[model samples]
Target: MKGKWHSSWLLLLIAVVLVLSACSSGNNSSSSADNKEEATSSGEPQDGGELKVGLSANPKTLDPILYTGVYESQIMRQVADTLVVYNKELSDFIPSLAKEWKVSEDMKVYTFTLRDDVYFQPGEYQDGRQMTAEDVKYSLERSAKESAMNRLRGVEKVEVTGEFEVEVHIGTPNAALLAMLTDSGNIIVPKEEVEGWGDQFGSHLVGTGPFQIKDWQKDSEVKLTRHDKYWGEKPHLDGVSFKIISDPNMMTNALRSGDLDVGTDIKGQNRELIKTDQNLELLSKPALSLTYLDLNNKKGPTADPKVREAIYKATNVEEIVKGVNQWGGAEPSFMGLPKQSWGYSKDLEKLKPTFDPEAAKKLLAEAGYPDGFKTELYLSEARVPYGTIFQNQMKENLNVDVELKVVEWGTYSDTVAKGNAPMSIGGWTWYPDPYFFLYQLFHTDQIGALGNGKGYSNPEVDSLLERAVSETVDQNERAKLYQQALEIILKDVPRIELDNLEASAGINKKVQGYDVSSDFSIIIVSPNGTNVWMKQ
Candidate 1:
């Protein structure tokens, strides 16, 4: 593990001057618009400073295109710029690298005008590698084959229109295209560095953002200095140092001891202890996190629908919301999708797995597990602050003996999402769209290694989600489509819908400029950590 290495922003990093074309100059929004930039509600403008962000788990890779989870994606968001960026608050999509774009009348082929000012950071590739229309083409084209982005390969064609523009001809009019662009994903990398980086690309990521990589030590720390060629507002902090320490208890202790400035996943399955700490401030709210227990159906003891029902009926989401998370922190849900997700049905929660022992035992008996079968529950540590809570609850409700397989983040992601493990535990951080959740978990035909253990197959559900995107219409119609999709998911029971956990952050009250929002979660700090300054 790499010990912490710190560098002052003012002294250690190059200050990037991102000169914007005048508002009328066909570039991004003007400097004034940039000033209005904020990370989320209560967040302020980008300033010069250094932020010490402590990560609970090490990053799989720094490559935005490859890393598929949380802080890793968020960190890449800071260091890269995509064609389209979600507004600082993630309320809407605004142009970033692509200066402007026009939707086709059919909405199937959207054309974008690239910005000439955008340039790749100087690296092994020669200096002044101006970002070209071809770079956009190559980047998106490469993403098609990317292991983490194979779902995106469905794209039909990417044509460079002109020196300043390109055209994306989709296989269909995907409503989720814009939403996907808003993901920390689709972050454009310099086409030059990608082909040769191999497995190292995730770690040696370089982008045209306000930040540039200084160094990264596996399972330890990653340091990013500022990128002066960046075309957007600069970061206030001189540099950012992210330290990876797995033990949640050690994480909280470090924050309380003032050894770390900020930490993620600061809870230890104990809310009261976190609430009483005076030295540290805990910042938490309804986050996009939703957990589940997946039953592998392709080849496993859980393949039987009766077994799936037995597990679901034995689960009580409401009991968990109270016994485990008491800070109004979670809602018992059989809602396959996140509560705030589009097409979330209040009625569906009732249809979703509920606390029905009778129904469960009946199914268990039919499945020949009259005396519930014992199985191992695989838990991903990168998920919630605690895995034992869900495991404990399972053992309590079903009277089924469960052995725990608590795995680290990287392998766990692949195991659960890629069908490597049966009856695995996982969570999805939803935002941009239901596709982020649905596209990953379902869609049996696409992306070979991905999908939550369950070989969930349903023509109706797949068609619904596919049509939801392929067809252009009002929001209400699309939502109805998703609800129908959820109906299929609920019935198939590939995963036992767990509760939607209300995300809370452990913030030191002293750290200023913490933007609190259920959608976006990035925060900034002042030089002294006394005042939380912002734009409006």
Candidate 2:
């Protein structure tokens, strides 16, 4: 083992460097919309314009129960309304479909008073109808039973207590229930639409949000139009157009040509181009996202624990992070949790694995692979740069030849979930709650597409996670439990975390009222529906 590195201090220093660099570049991109000049701020926010946004990949499905990738959630978020939503600061929850809610002292039972005014968008299943307590019961129960993400894991039952009131019973006191509800997996769905479309439910979706799915041209675009009967204030824009642009270069070009109002997942040279462009403004935030390299614990060569450890030792995670995010959009990390999260701690940082190529070689030899073995690294096209850097590092340091397998986004996720990918590079973005990160990613019950696709299982880790959610409602106590679990997970070497991503986007300055969110929920439409207006 090697001695500890001052990664925490390094992160602080990098942050300072980035700040100074931004100051030097006078019209640089910013995290706040206030920094950019809105062409018509003096007038009332304009309406009736279609805002076109670019996505990095295609969504696999629109059904909350089955969608796996962030690309899908990004679109789904516009159409669906959760019981509650994260406040702008992400400190507490605010009302959405649920007007108000009360939790029992034990934290197992929650009573929610639904908004009687909310209505589902018009669909073939039914002409828009009022949403009630039954809708909450249906949505929560469906998510608890069949969500691909295992979102409502501890939900025991959901009962319609009254026309506008429902009670959710948990098997155990769950502290992450609200946070989980904020995820796309638990978005309220109408029973009629879900049963009416069946397998095609996602393709023809209906929700009670300000926007509704107008059309989805597979692999081309998902067009959303204003929901006329929405309970909340009508949206300032007529609709949103989520254009599927897989290539980063094409995405940038679209934004530059004014074909797209917003371009997401902006990286490398494209960020520089946006910052320098007078017509475009950059929006960036230190995201609550982790990019990682998963070492399959149940497949082929990586099945050997020593091989997994050797791979960790062989990796220079810092170098790989720098090489991929050259424009200061990510920070090297040793664990799954992001520094911005409340659960992130200095104690956990102490357990970061040391990079020692000699130690790696010895371990590989002891694992009965005197000659370095070859393996496939599965990843999406957007992750090719990360794969390339990792592929080269393994070859140079450990003499391990890595075959880069670039597949489509949906295929890549399915392949990894099936444990067919021996090695892979992936990323996860969610709210600040530790359970959203640790429990879903490391818990035994979360195997496959639910989040633990690496086939990792640890009883001790599972117990800690359960206790963290059910045993305590105190923030400090829950954080401690999560930190303890993360410590154990890091030692297991199930994954080599590359970095905590700094999400960046290029936006047309004409599109006003935008703020970057750490969770990757880029479009922030206010409850009053006053934000996200297009400049006339």
Q: Which number leads on lDDT?
A: 2
lDDT for each residue of candidate 2 in 374-482, tens digit (9 for 90 to 100): 9999998988989998899899888899999999988888988887888989888778998888877888887876367899999999999999988767778998999
Question: What local distance difference test score does each model get?
Answer: 0.67, 0.86
State residue 230's C-alpha deviation in candidate 1, in Å.
3.5
**Model 1: per-residue lDDT, tens digit, 423-494?**
776666766467667766787664344454667877888888888777764457887888888877888777
Instruction: Score candidate 2 by lDDT.
Output: 0.86
Q: Candidate 2: list runs displaced more than 4 Å.
A: 1-48, 58-61, 66-69, 122-128, 145-151, 189-204, 213-222, 295-314, 354-384, 391-426, 444-460, 491-494, 528-530
